[model samples]
Target: MNIQLNQLIPIPLKEKILQGSSDIWNNNVVISKGDYLKIVAPSGTGKTTLTHILWKLRTDYTGEVQYDGCNINGINAQVMASFRQQKLSVIFQDLRLFGHLTAIENIELSRIKSATPGVGAHEVLEMAETLGVSHILNQKANTCSYGEQQRVAIIRSLVQPFEILVMDEPFSHLDENNTLKAAGLIEKVCKQNNAGFVLMDLDEDSYFEYTHSLKL
Candidate 1:
């Protein structure tokens, strides 16, 4: 139940915005154990870039990012991939699903690749059901509506064994009702798993239930 951003991976920010001279991002934001961190920011505020840096996807950034009190930069690519598969789960705003794969297959594929225990088809299906995606379990990911796909993505993260869940603009594609529904579902799952969650969204009013927040 320990998470840390050590001295390596400094996570410094310059005047780089999506488009601006001023620094939209400040210093590094750390997620402690069992914390649900909601990052509130404007559209082009570099929230996703911060997330990518944290996940080690964009290592060219100026600072260090650590996890579990260890400097992630010291890990090799294979070790980093292993750490990511074992400890981190990310949900992109666009719902990055394999179009040709079934909803369940998308979840199962991650299980197979990572060999993460306890994430079988049945478990994934149950998670999808809890997220109101049972009926579309066998459907192609590309065929489902945006809300359904988003739910599927959430289910994928939930069933996998991960310590951290990173979501970027998770509620952007949903309507009012589905947005509320999805947020509730995500909250329930995170609490049940005792996992840390970092959600980046401009919808400040949407996530008031979060325990804590980090504003960029």
Candidate 2:
């Protein structure tokens, strides 16, 4: 499960933009197996940029992101998309979902489209039940409460057979109670799947109980 970043894809920056810049991420950052890594930073601190670089979306950057000793920058878009679909899952703070689809339908969509095995409608329903969203499964995503939609989004991530879960400020919209519940669900899913997680957030305290922290 070793993840490495290698090679370099130079990104040109205007002189004005680099006027006072002294720090740049040019080297590889290795994330070990079964580790829960936290990337903490304030808003606009390049956390999302780093995530995109690692996930092979921002290939114009000055470095390459490798996973399990292979440089992914050389891979094609379809390969990268397949990797993202099967082995890597992302949960955004906005909780991206289809407005017309039901909570269960959202999860089921991921299962149906995924190349990984062991995920289906039954599994999606079970995950939703575990996250306390069984009652809202049939409800449209746009009609559900924010907290419920958040849980649904998380369950969608769980339904994928991802070895690495990259979450960007997933708990920002939840109340105190739902935050705890979501954290618990995240921990349960990660442990059950033996998956490593990369959580990006400014509030490290909220995730302290679920995973170790690493400030970037």
Candidate 3:
């Protein structure tokens, strides 16, 4: 699948935020399948907001956001929801886990409305173990450390099938070694699935060999 943005600009930002080098805030771009892309910007730059818009969580932004050549804004809410469930997965900055539930339970609640087969609980546990958080899976999400919760969020996002995975500061809580581990896991899975990824971060450095980089 390919996402084409044609002069897509976030509204209410023309007067507030200063423009960047390529005018990405008000310009055009393409995110193709198998593309590994990064969005690097400082705080308050709408990195999270952009991801939300891509996944239909927000409608305040202006201009066209096309999914596989179809105008996303033209679709009804039901169809949009279906599109996200089947084709998009996201690791939100806030983690968005059910804090009262066990990590495994929280991970298991991922939307599996896609045509592809859903991941089993054992596979979810394996992903947690790979990220070094298997033991914590039985614990309540709120009781786990921030890093452990982040790993839980990663597992939750990965268990579903997707064409595009959006990560908003996904490794903010991890050290270099753990960050490398998480990135490697994402790379391996994305390659296997032939899915593209869009990662938003604070700096230019990235663990994956990115196909493209842009500033907000």
Candidate 4:
């Protein structure tokens, strides 16, 4: 599977929100399966916006993006939903965990039992433990700290079937150690499935030893 950014540039932004030119917005690109892509941009340069567009969460932009040959702009809601559930999983910047549910329940919600090549409860718990959140598994998501919630969201993303795993500043809440732990788990899972891993961050840190880097 591959995602093609065919002149896939967002519309122009005002000088206030963004200044100067951006390479991503001025070029076409392609990211294939198993590719590790790091999109590094400064704040207010639309890092989240690019991630949303790649995840098909927004369309208030210019150009066409083809996901494995299916034009993203043409897909209906049902198809898009299925695509998201089965082929793409995202760790949104907001974390988006269910506030009322316990951490384990929140992670389990991402599971589709009938979906083959999917992660199991064992793996979910394994990841939670790996990220140092196993002790909080019984706590409600809303009650957990932001860092804890971030780990919960990471585990949740792993429980689903996906060909491309997208992350939007998933490590923003973690320190260097936690970031390494989380990134390690993510890389392990992505390698096992040969899935593409795309992350958008504000700085060009030596994050993940990212195989490719794009500036926005």
Better structure of 1 and 4 per lDDT: 4
Pairs of colliding residues, candidate 2: none
lDDT of 1 by residue, 103-190 (tens): 9888776766677553566766666666678999899999999888888887776666677788888777677776677777667766
For each candidate, what is the lDDT?
0.70, 0.72, 0.82, 0.83
Query: What TM-score would you give candidate 2 relative to the actual structure?
Result: 0.81
Q: Give the Å shift of residue 144 in candidate 2.
A: 2.7
Task: Give the per-residue lDDT digits (tens) of candidate 2, residues 133-208.
Answer: 8999999999999889988988888777777888888877777777777777777777877888888888666554
What lDDT score goes with residue 194 in model 2? 82
RMSD of 2: 3.4
lDDT, candidate 3, at 201: 92
Model 4's TM-score against the true structure: 0.92
Better of 2 and 3 by TM-score: 3
Supply every candidate's count of residue pairs whose N, Cα or C atoms clash at under 3 angstroms. 8, 0, 0, 0
Clashes of 3: 0
CA lDDT for candidate 1: 0.70
Judge candidate 1 at residue 177 and give its lDDT: 73
